[model samples]
Target: MNIPLNRHSPTPIYLQIRNYLSRLIQSGKMLSGQKLPSIRVLSTSIQVNKLTVIEAYSLLEADGLIHARQGSGYFVNPKTTVTSGLTLRSNFSPSQEVIISQGGGSFFEQYTTSIQARRQQNIIEFSSGFPSTSISDNLQRVAKRALAKAGDTLFREDFPQGQLLLRQLIAQMLIQQGLEVSSEEIIITSGSQQALSLAMQYYLRKDDWVIVETPTYHGALGILKNLQAKVIGIPMTAEGINLELLEQYLKSHRPKLIYTISTLHNPTGITTSLAHRQALITLARQYECFILEDNAYEGLKFQPVPPPIKALDRYDLVTYISTFSKTLMPGLRIGYMVVTGEHHQPLVKQKLLNDLHVSTVSQVIVSEFLASGHYRRHLNRLRISNLQSRNVMLQALESYFPDAIAWTIPKGGLFLWTHLPNHLPIQTICSEALSHNVLIASGAAFFLGQGYPAMRLNFCHTPEDIEHGIKIIGRLIKNYLTPSFISVGLSSQEVSVSSMR
Candidate 1:
């Protein structure tokens, strides 16, 4: 594998090596179990410092891409394949055909396939609503510091509700946002996804109706469908979820729960206004229903974040869920929920059965980080970075894509929802783009039951990478729309374009 050495470039030499090696491994050019050149040999070949090669190799090893031996060089591990695939086996029956008539089982398959396929490719992933790796370093450092101070005591089982310190920290955090939450009200879970799952388990019964946004987070959609809940989707507008339609659903179908992302809504990057929040809260109270507010993207906001729906909730019906995944780190998987009114006990019980509690070490570390002033400083840095990246992606999109493709300019959050012209087949475009070496998430995965012709592009993960990837996408779209190009099959060069696009 040849890695271009750019001494004049501002990028660190090690990162250049890391990126080159990562690309090679991802493209299957460097097979699993293949040994990378020795650090000395690499340093000699590249004419860089030996320590630079060592640093790059170490970084790659830490990322789970390769393993080091005492006497031998680094070798790619077999686990890389599974890690790259990101496929998890579900306990549910695999034979359940994913047909539309089969009650959304097939829809789950499409979601899983999109995620797994993206993981397998080397594309700059704007499809996932996850934080960039730079944010994770702070969390990791916090965890390490906690371990150094606490030692082996952290290995023991923690309180069923999670560490008290973390709970208190979470409570204080919520209070600052104008919610009068207590430590007892917060229940720690694996992540926001688990928090949502716990809420579903506590409230949803099979075939019970639930109201969700028309195109929502796929994971939430999957969980609700897995629970066998009859989901009624209210179409989202620039203002957020249509309150009138939501009320109509409440009146007509009497949904038990209304799951929403009010603050910096996912996939579409639209936040519900204060008026809409109050309206939804009032409607929930009027209908005597629960509002599961997923505020996962709350902290990632570039603009002043709006008050959460829970803050406006007076009836004790809003179950507020948020996580450090987007703001801090996704891998930490630390999420908390605030349950109000009479639902606290049952929800806590459901959480206990699901995973007993979130990791105690994670809780303590994150809590300590919050108390240390580190979290605040890190958040400041993240906000600036996110804002810059968001601007970069927006400019790239506007410059590269066709005028027919419309997108929302989100105030904050990782995603930008783009809609193709009505006649354009998103799946076909995605498939055709894949053949050209550019990968994009099809819009259909975001829908609850049927697919749509829109795609959610995450803009904050890698701005420069997104720029290059979108250029490929623009080129591919242009080719697809051209009648002359349609007559000829895609070539190998076109496939490369698709993969990167």
Candidate 2:
């Protein structure tokens, strides 16, 4: 038997032998009941060690493709009966719904809920939307320091708009960034999700057109879907969303709302240039559409990005939203939006209707943290630690991942967006990853239409786990590639990490 091998390749020799033999068996090159060569003879023929040949034979034996008699060599198993493709398709059931009956939710709704509610587990979290919990102990100190000078203002609500001090603090910070705004313009909420939902409720009616980037934030997409907006998804280029397409849609459809993440955009992490920002603002003006800018990762930038689209919103077309979820603590659940147009009153009214207002305590605690000058220090530390984490993941991707795979190494932010080779079955690969105790955010969930062969990996995980998870994913992909048909090796059973080792 001729077995071609690349001894210098990173793939283990035993795995290569097993795969090659598996391929031959499936292809019927080796006849059923044919006696195989002895280990010593096969090793000499392949110019490999005897142990390597033995391990390969052992694997094939375990796979049930070959059998070794008591004193004789191995023999290939008989070919399994083949079912016609048409017969299988005739049996295929389309439109079947997997009803998970815990609360009886729709598939997409249940999917999004499960994603958001993934309990903290001992396993590495590659799908988390929040930062690490290493700061939990430190936050007690922040909370204690924030409460030092709490007067009656801390006990009682400041006003209908929210704690006036927090609003003033948020407004002052925006002013420092060159936005002309006041405390009265800011509306605090439970989190940016609430801020976004309020904006959606106030402006968007059922079937009103709205524009969003392809591969946009899933949360925003879910909100827009729930609001029943006629959503238009523009493909995002390196600079930002495709402007040509934006203009085309604006001229044709005239969407009422243009929701965007102008800086360090969510999954892709591509920041819009100042020119792109200016052009987008102009497009909104030309089309008379409102801009809803989510700036959740604003302060997390390692390299400076262009000023936010909201900063350039002299036209009052932009409703700027930000939150402490990315920068400080998600548990605080405090976020605010700056509204400055004719819709300001209605938006604030919607905010009041949403939850009356965010918790008085959260607003006060966040307010005190900002007022104490500790927030700036916290921002600095966050940038440093996250950047290091980003580098570690980048190195892992470089060392462990294959060359055909493409990924983004963001200047900041917790995610690394990756594109695998097009032909790979990404869903099956993701399913296999789950079996290995590794979780990933499939690129399909982020798209409005067909998803690319991609995944969004969180680089902010424990460094050791990051390395281990990525290496495991790479190996799984290679294993799939080896079997070619995604049906050969893993046809009847899963090849797990334990099995691989």
Candidate 3:
């Protein structure tokens, strides 16, 4: 392995290595079925992170130039078509254009600004993804009890993997849900967002191909863009992710990872069937790719749903991430992931470098809360309240919204995915709604490619607010559709909020 890296080049070191190897394989210098240097040996010879070498080899594998045998090193694929290999443009990458060109602001930036702007305006917001519940008296009591029990341990540096007690409780909860994970395998983070960041940083490098659901969680899209990974969006169908398109991408692209929200998916509120779960697991196994399953809203569902893709994973390929923010207070920010095998040590190291660990007080309190069984009781109450709120919103949409506008009836979760007529742009609608003191999430924020005319409305507000908000949005759409309004070429800014009120 005589590959050299350009310290001045804009392209990543991993891609540089991958390109060099690809050229060799295609040019016949590396023969078919011949073993290449092992990851450890090659990384030592080149003086780079082992993960970087792994990434380069993984890309070569994805390009069909090589294959790996367990307990053995990677080898040139015997049946590879040697056509100059996958080309890397000299001065361009898709990620450089993805964030700035698609939509300027990220989901976090947009919603944070929205929250601040509306803090004094008393705006009823449908843009939030979590239930806005205050800390209960019982939670306060639990926190005090946890503090009392902390003794001197709270003052000392704790494990990077997080509080063991919290992990044990989480493992028990997961066991009830059908996953065979233990406390040692779990790593606690500030939130599921941090967990996602760790996994992405560990597995994905620049120009690596990854698959995601179109209209997926905007947070994940933001992370992928930041990491400079190429994303392919597979549309969500009635059951789950479009398996047909997923498999096709698997065969042709050989993506490194599949990111999915299997149960109580955000924005759309679609849960896949058991068979759909099985098929997804099978596809990932056949393709020899990993799956990052975000089950953030799993606890919010009203009906019974299938176990997570992790529970069905026989090959230890799925990385399961979830958070207590959706069920508990969002400020708690306690999330965990179950990692096994080679990925564990690296992810833990990344976690240590990222923030050391989640807040000690937050982890301790949550641990005590779970141990006391208050968490289950809180979930039951939350489900009932959210269900009532959802029903009210549905009724309001039926009464105030036009027949042309449609929305999904979610079994559980905070959002209702609404589809607007293709002729209308969601960005204009969101801006006009904001002027009227109603904030909604424009669907444009959720896509990596071309976005559709849709919006995600949260059902976590009061019945009165939900009805009033829906009515205002419906009126805005109706006004936009009116013949006189359209003929006059009235802009969204020209629409009078006073008249609507």
Candidate 4:
């Protein structure tokens, strides 16, 4: 093996040696299953201390790129993909997050694994993006009425554009929110997810440039990856997406779409200010780009919220979407989007090609629920319940979480984004929390490339579990931060107590 040692550099000699060997393996210079030089030989060959060579080999072994037998020298791990010039994993992981060089790495794989693990442990998802269970009774009542109304047409499918009555109701609701649009412009979808997919399918082509708010909605990011679009994420401040930065991107990239959940944004809990909304609309018009406004968390605000960006879209530049999933019930699978202009016909046709139409029975139920004003009453009750639940979560976070941890206090939404200390190992924290049967949504899943130490905590679904989970998680973080943390993890008795709590 030919290797040069740089003694004057700031990087540790062990790390440098590890990196050189890593490059050789990655570039296929070192074949898989090939033995590395013996520690004595390499140490003498490089004129380095044996300890430095040992440390380098140990690091490589930990990376799964190499292995050692009791008697044999280190050999490259045959299972590695480095021989083919592929990385074993993305830079982002549950344990340590590094800045992404490119977007569209598979975040769902890690995220879903965490969820499935929690389910195996029978963990009630406090980190669920779903709404509070308190509305189940009201939902059942409306569902029955809807089923009765759909007795004959239950088998008959609605048009490709969706059930007209539901669209009319959605149009009415949007009008009240100051977005003037006729029912003809609206298309009912299976859910906000489908609506988003339809829009991306209609307007975006492979390799298309798309702009989105940093740490926006995870679902939208997932969709963007499926569509094979190049995603540009604009970091958001307390005010909202940085307009100055957005303008720079708009000027440079002129992306075809700007996808955002401007109202009580998912993960972050920020509602873009009305002035910012108006500015964004103007920018979209100037750049001839379309704005896809995902208002999934439109209502449930603790206070009067700003109007959606769609409301200010005078040039028909904004495609507005919202759903009953967050406000009412998710099982309904009913959502709608108002789209007109050039993209209208294709979206309807594409939606038809996808699903003939959203569930007819579900749409009928939602229509009656909305037209009878029951939805309004339900929304009021929902706001109160969610507000109380959010407060419970906030208090728990404030009381139990470490001082190094900071979190958002969204005015009204199911999520509170918690930012962990940068230097801490998020992967270890996530693993420890799982031992306690608590789950958290990794913040990395929501970003295009914004790798940071954070996770989104859901407050509505597990209101009762907030205090308990927070207590357990707080203790775990404390232990990990202290000098005594030795990965001893939680005791079985301790885990059982947590599960009981």
Best by TM-score: 3
**For residues 140-240, could you state the per-residue lDDT of candidate 2 as single tens digits?**
78787666667565666445568888999998767645566889888888889888988887878987888887667878877876776767777665567
lDDT of 4 by residue, 1-501 (tens): 668878999988998999999889878889988999999999999889998998787656534467665577778865311123322221111221112222455456755664474556467465567775454565687778878877889888679998778888888777657688898999988888899988988779998888887777777777888888877777666667777768877887778988888888887887778888889999999999999999888766766677788877777788999888888877789888888777678889999999888888788888888876567656755665666677777777767876556666687878778766555677787777877788766676776664556778887745568778888877877776643322222111111001110
Q: Which ranges in model 2 have alpha carbons more than 4 Å from their true place?
A: 1-121, 151-155, 482-501
Arrange candidates, best TM-score first.
3, 4, 1, 2
Residue 24 of model 1: what lDDT? 85
Write the candidate numbers in order of decreasing lDDT: 3, 4, 2, 1
Error of 2 at 165 (Å): 0.7
Q: What range of 10 consecutive residues in model 2 has the weakest lDDT sum?
A: 92-101
User: Which regions of candidate 1 are displaced past 4 Å?
Assistant: 1-121, 135-140, 482-501
lDDT of each: 0.71, 0.72, 0.78, 0.74
Error of 3 at 400 (Å): 0.9
lDDT string, candidate 1, 225-306, tens digits: 7888877767776677767667766887787998898877777778778888888899999998988999888876655566
Estimate the TM-score of every prediction: 0.73, 0.72, 0.75, 0.73
In terms of TM-score, how similar is model 1 to the real structure?
0.73
lDDT (Cα) of model 1: 0.71
Best by lDDT: 3
